[model samples]
Target: MFSGLSAFPLTPMNESGIDEAAFVRLIERLADASVDSIGALGSTGSYAYLSRAERARVVKLAVEHAGNVPVIAGIGALRTSDVQALSDDAQKAGASAVLLAPMSYQQLSADEVFGLYETVTRSLSVPLCVYDNPGTTHFEFSSELYGRIAQLPNVRSIKIPGVPANPAAAKAHIESLRALIPSHVTLGVSGDASAAMGLNSGCEAWYSVIGGLFPKTALAITRAAQAGDMKAATRLSERLQPLWALFDQHGGSLRVVAAAAELQGVVEHPCLPLPLKALDGTGRQQLAVLLDELELA
Candidate 1:
């Protein structure tokens, strides 16, 4: 479940709350494309903004529509107790695994972070993926912290933020982390722009954002890397540099992808939750042009 492409789909929403039909369409799209796993309620799914009940519903819907593909539900919350509760909800909803990031309002020490994982892992029946997303969580994990959390009972995968751009440095970075964790715990790479390089550098999986909406395009790069065709993987990823550029220009991928989903009619015009706006008119115009040029429209 941790290997290959784990596609994180947007939790499409409307004024009425979750757009069930649209969300189902997105799940079925990934399933039809044969993605390795479906990541529900991740950052892309707007998990943080949703209530516990909403997150539970999202995971349930994902598992129900994902067919045989495994569902990895994001169970991140600010409090350890809340995270534990969400973990319970994910297990009850039949999630194959749960992704937990150390989400916090105040900064957390390394010991506190380790304690969070240690406490949550104890009651978890399903495997857990260590979500080291420093960008959103605002808490970084050191190599020692990773080693400690990985020693817990359910730790199965560690989702690192991104790899270095240079191939040799990327390989060395992955190798260093590999040595810290148990051999059974797979290393998955996030950051869509560097996914090809990460995979080609020996990471076992790609926890992807773009893979959620355009599974075929993401799969092309994934398959090339898995097949030992490094050049092919790099070529495919480089072809999408324009899209990657949009992610950078717009601050992050959530808004850009939300805009793309709206443009493609996969969801409503403004799919993001309150307090977050969709791309501006100029950004949308630029995205629309690129989407057509890249045949992603």
Candidate 2:
């Protein structure tokens, strides 16, 4: 069921806590854009930074307001019990599925990774998507491990980081993933920059960052790629190049999204949680030029 474009919302924050009003508005905007799914507390949503109670609140709000779209709650945590508890909270909050990553304090083995999912699967009735973001988790999953996890009960999707930014390598990588996984499970690509290539190469979905803030544009590109109109998708991606450049230069998309959302007047604060500051003034100014070039300002 996790197919097409999935928008990973940046949890809109303010000093008082999650800006519920702003959060609601962002969700409604995504729904209006007709994104395929809404990931309420994905990485872009800063799942790691929020308290358990705060995460539950976000899931509840997302499911309540997501309309017909599926709300997939991010249930990843450092400990197994915490992940299971969060999974329960997500189910109780009426999320359609839980996105799980093998987040760990120390390096994890493939067996440990499998064990984590095995335990979570036993506890959760909702469908689970194995989130393979090695960049953040410091855990990696080979195609062999993916098949093993896919065999587990209720494990329905795998959201993996996109291939190397190079187009040919990305295409080959996606084809290999398609060849590895069973037809029952969907393979989604997470890196927003390579989403068009992945979609065109038969990956079922785009777990997107920009889509969270600019779902209309994201959906447009997705539709183009899915319709076999690479030219159209390329045009859209070109327009988005400057934004993606900042993501490459700044280490990741969180700070960039924070700035873009505020630049577009979508959120009250461009800030992230402590230790992860918003883009500095110079960075914001640079982003503003790019956003303006894209007509987002």
Candidate 3:
């Protein structure tokens, strides 16, 4: 049922801290744009930086603003108990599902991975979405492991990033998920720019960081592609090309999305933690150039 434009929102923060008003306004904008669902506290939300209480509050605000819409809360954590805590808070806040990435501590064997999943699954009271964000967590789950993990009662879906060593292997992994995994579990596609291509290749939804800043264009692209209208899809994708371009020329998803937030006037403070920097003057100017080229500045 998680099939369509999935928006990963940017967690709004100001001098005082998590800006609830800005956060709600951002969600409202996405809602007006007809985004299918929302994934909160993922990389786009700067999950690693937020405290436990702060993260819970953000999830609550997302659910409140989203109303009946499916708000998928992110539960990626270094510690297993922390994942459960996030999941619990998400459920309390009215989230529809919890997206869990693997432990970010160290490299884990397939055997150890399954054990970790089993532990979380046992305590999970809400639906679980496996987040295969290899870029950050360095843990790309194998298809052989997925077939087994998908059998968990709480396991509901997965969001796989497209950055695989062997690109075809990632596609092969997705194909295996379709074939071996149960039919009930949904599979969403990620990797910002090529989301449309993944949808055509059998992914159910397109999870996008660009969606937070430009939901209208993001959903437009997804909807157009879903309807098999390549021309319309191309048009919408072109509108979002600027955001992806910023991502390519900048740091990672947070900096890119934060830059879009600044450019779009969504947040007041887009600062990240130490070692993680926001888009600077030259970077901002470069992004502005891209936006100008797209006529969206």
User: In order, how many clashes per candidate?
Assistant: 0, 0, 0
Off by over 4 Å in 2: none
lDDT ranking of the models = 1, 2, 3
**Model 1 C-alpha lDDT per residue in residues 1-297, reported as the tens digit of each score:** 989999999998855688888899999999999999999988999999899999999999999999999999999999999999999999999999999998999999999999999999999999999999988988888988898899999999999998999999999999999899999999999999999999999999999999999999999999999999999999999999999999999988999999999888888877888788778789999999999999851
**Model 1: residues with Cα > 4 Å off, grouped in runs:** none
Q: What's the lDDT for all of these models?
A: 0.93, 0.87, 0.77
Better of 1 and 3 by lDDT: 1
TM-score of 3: 0.90
lDDT tens digits, residue span 179-279, model 2: 77778899898888878777777788889988888888899988898888977887887778878888988988988888888877888664577677667
Candidate 3: regions farther than 4 A off:
14-16, 163-173, 238-242, 295-297
Better of 1 and 2 by TM-score: 1
* Ranking of models by TM-score: 1, 2, 3
Residue 91 deviation, candidate 2, in Å? 0.5
lDDT of 3 at 206: 83
Alpha-carbon RMSD, each predicted model: 0.9, 1.5, 2.7
Model 1's number of clashes is 0
Q: Against the hidden reference, what TM-scores do the models get?
A: 0.98, 0.96, 0.90
